[model samples]
Target: MRTKLATAVGAAALIVVGIGGAQQASAAPKAAPQAGLSGSKTWGNTVGWATCSGTGTFRVKAICKWEGDKHTSWVTLRGGSAKLVPPACRFKIERIGVHQSV
Candidate 1:
């Protein structure tokens, strides 16, 4: 008799735990979208082949290097697309990064 009572209580406890787990899983929040750095490359005398995507404001930054000179280049992006144009001197991209803005 005692063994049957213990088994019934254990089964009831398992049902209650399973219901709580199901409710918590259904109520969980989804993740929000975020921006990211896509890629960078040289094209002719410009650095226009850079790409970025996803949500929020972002900036694509690059160092344009030519001979003995290098300068900072960047482009502001919103949600979808943007472009980066360095100084119009025969140059190549030496380094790159992404920055989130307000």
Candidate 2:
């Protein structure tokens, strides 16, 4: 009876340690992707394309129509003919259209 109780206690302790270790392992640091020249990134917050997009260190009103999340995030941009412009190499933002890529 004593041996059985000790074994059970030991097993429970090991299980606890194993679970803790697993959690810590998953908390390891991860590398972030490279950002483009227009580095106005807001993760969950949506901003006007002018607010986010860039045009030679300035924001263009006509180009500002392209509004959405950062390139790191997934967005659905579709409407009329998609007119896109590459403000940055990583992603090609639309210049004129119903939806913008950036």
Candidate 3:
């Protein structure tokens, strides 16, 4: 009887842990600036693209590309490198119009 009780307890514990894990996995990650912020440039293609408000995981990954127009170059914003408290966010660039006007 003791052995049976122990087994049952273990099973119950497993079930609880499993349920918790599932809930965490299924829960939608809250995204910061949860809308088009017009400054969160994720990507671009010579002309137009999408922009985000900030950077962070929000049930989906952030991605954008842009061409600098005398201001930024090769601009991009991505998710955090670690589990960010507020989340490290920035715009990345890989070009230099240098007054060339991208």
- lDDT on C-alpha atoms for all candidate structures: 0.51, 0.34, 0.36
- Please say which candidate is ahead in lDDT: 1 or 3: 1
What TM-score does prediction 3 earn?
A: 0.31
Q: How would you encode candidate 1's per-residue C-alpha lDDT over 26-45 as one tens digit per residue?
A: 66332112334354444444
Compose the digit string of candidate 3's lDDT tens values, residues 1-102. 999999999999999998998897455333334442223323332222233333432222322235212222222335432221111224543322111101
Worst lDDT 10-window in candidate 2: 41-50
- TM-score per candidate, chains pooled: 0.33, 0.31, 0.31
Ranking by lDDT: 1, 3, 2
What's the CA RMSD for each of the models?
A: 18.0, 15.6, 15.6
* Maximum-TM-score candidate: 1
Q: Considering only N, C-alpha and C atoms within 3 Å, which residue pairs clash in candidate 1?
A: none
Q: For model 3, what is the error of residue 76's alpha carbon versus the real structure, in angstroms, after optimal superposition?
A: 8.2
Q: What alpha-carbon RMSD in Å does predicted model 2 have with respect to the real structure?
A: 15.6
Error of 2 at 3 (Å): 0.5
The per-residue C-alpha lDDT of model 1 at residue 59 equals 48
